[model samples]
Target: MSLPLAPGLAGTRILLGISAGIAAYKSAHLARLLKKSGFEVRVVMTEGAQAFITPLTLQALTGEPVRTSLLDPEAEAGMGHIELAKWADVILIAPATADLMARLAHGHADDLLTTLCLATEARCLMAPAMNQAMWRHPATLANADRLVELGWILLGPDAGDQACGDVGLGRMLEPETILAQLLDELEPARDEALRVMPVHRDLVGRRVVITAGPTREALDPVRYLSNHSSGKMGYALAAACAERGASVTLVSGPVTLSTPPGVERIEVISAAEMLTAVESRMPCDLFIGCAAVADYRAAAISEHKLKKTEDASGLTLELVRNPDIVATIAARPDRPFTVGFAAETQALETHAGSKLERKRLDLVVANDVSREGVGFGGDDNAATLLWRERERTRRHTLPRQPKTALANAIVDHIADRMR
Candidate 1:
């Protein structure tokens, strides 16, 4: 999903600091994504990160030569470190490794990255990436807490499979996810302080399930059919709900979107797989069908690639309709407050209204995909929410905003309805 660029970061200068860790590889992508999101990115890499990724790669992505050594004589002209430090609007450190964290905690300015951090007054954002054990270490936690107290933004050590072949916490957030978080921080909600100060425990203990992305229907061993669903909306909803203290379970189709912090994500592929996964986690307080499930799948599976024969003029494969997952869930006796999405080209209200009634959905979010810039695969979305009664319906024409912002709005509406 495309996120609306915040004025706070657009054309703003950002100094990206890369440190040593397995997650350094992600820093390259993060730098590129940041540049694409309209930040002027300058990369500063520690010697350790250079061990894993090339300075050339980061330079290519940022369109600026990578700065590594603190002692480079040419770079030191006119007090380069201090000058670069003063030039930044924000200093973001990705893969802020355990070693770096310790150094930063104690104000150790041994390297260029650390020295720059000490020299700069720019807002700092750090993404701690390390082994799960290292992340949980008492010293690391204390240092991180101290950093947070000092007004540094901590992005994530998201829970998931780590490069160390162990699954738990301590995974660096994906580039797009980090970019979204950065946007959120830079362009905080107009009423962010007020909203956060209030405790809306309306969903304090509620279990909410959300599905996201486009399901892949395998056509062969290597080929598959999928839609343009980016999973951005669903992931954003998950994050929003979690922020509201809801226990969120995200049953996601294949997408590059990262699982929101504090969300339990169950990854699946085909529509059938999604169904099985959701059903296994049923009896929740809410179920959101945000994924674009494939309508049909190959009727028969082929073990190998079907080769063309000399006499064959063409090949036709049969297809069968995939199960309607949301409808089936809504039909259950223990169904949660069901929400579905309707993406239409024409007669959006008419079609979405029908779907709402026919599928027994408590709420349906309808979007006009036919319009430019506001639907399927785009970061921004404009939705007209539909319910049984016309008076109860509400049309929310969201500005060309981030999908996460839209998701937060949708979740707020849902929470209000639940209350």
Candidate 2:
């Protein structure tokens, strides 16, 4: 599928940096994808990259002349690097070789790409592509981390088979993945302009707490009662808030989703444990109850496996209610903007509206979990946001998108409400 370009990139200039690596072949596809997505793409190559991919290939895909030299007289009409730097909305380097990474880390600007990178005020993203061992080496990892610290978005060196008959994690991500990430970085909802607004900074120094995933209530040590929630939505919220300069604490139930880049994560297994985790982060600016906590738990613990008798058809077990974490937090005297999620199978609005009132939430995000490709483990989600006032309800039908995109949208709504 053709991924959507960043809204900001329409008619926007993008400088594509291709470095020497076997993965340089993929840069041709990356350029084509960028052009198809409405970007005015300009390709810049290093001397080493020319060995793997011809300039003719990139020139054809980009529909623009490729620039590979810092000393080109025609390109230097207006101080080439500075002009190119000012022309771009973003600088993306794919197949960023280990050598190039080291040069960037040490502030080396010997080549055209590095020079443009250093001179640009635009956002920068790098997709590192190298041999597995080179990627794993301490120096490369440290350089990558340093780039991140300097505000560069590192796309990936995903794990997979390598060209040299070896495999483990140094493969450059597919072109589509890199393009998707670039779109995200370029279209971040909470832009720098928003940051300077007085209303935007309301949650500036506030500690925001969130819960995510399905809590597993053990029926036995081997089995548990849990839903199919992937914890993606909640994790996305945590990451979004953190990006907007909020101090965030994520109390997450058992999930495979990685912790969002800068947020603090506390892991828990059962509903009771989740309650404790939420309670511990109280008196924050915002509290989000996104976890699908089990309403009932096994009343008694079992020390050992119970034997099934041939004569018995079934076994009886008592159940008890788990603590209502959101309600409890809302009841606090100094409550933050309380948000809760209502995943319903039927009568979505009516049920969500009632839940919003009963739970005393500032806002509730309700969705039909019954719909295919929207809720639970799916990457995309569609939600109807209901405010406590009862008269205002907005339907936000997010396209089948990455969880992070949905998360950004959710946080943007919250930020708007705060205003």
Best by TM-score: 1
Query: Candidate 2: lDDT over CA atoms?
Result: 0.80
Q: Candidate 2 at residue 109, lDDT?
A: 94
**Per-model TM against the reference:** 0.56, 0.55
Candidate 1 lDDT over 1-419, as tens digits, reads: 33657555568899999999989998888887888778899999999888999999999988898899999899898788998999999999998998898898888999999999999999999988888667656677677766766667777667677888876456787777888778877876743733333323345446688899999988888777788888888888887776664657799998987667857788999999999999997888899998989999999868787777778588888999999999999999999999999988999988998888889998999888888998877878888887765556545554556676777777778887877
lDDT, candidates in the order shown: 0.82, 0.80
What is the Cα-based TM-score of model 1? 0.56
Model 1 pairs whose backbones collide: 1-379, 2-379
Q: What does candidate 1 score in Cα RMSD to the true structure?
A: 10.1
lDDT per residue (tens digit) for residues 266-332 in model 2: 8899998998888887777789899998989998767677668788679888889888988888888
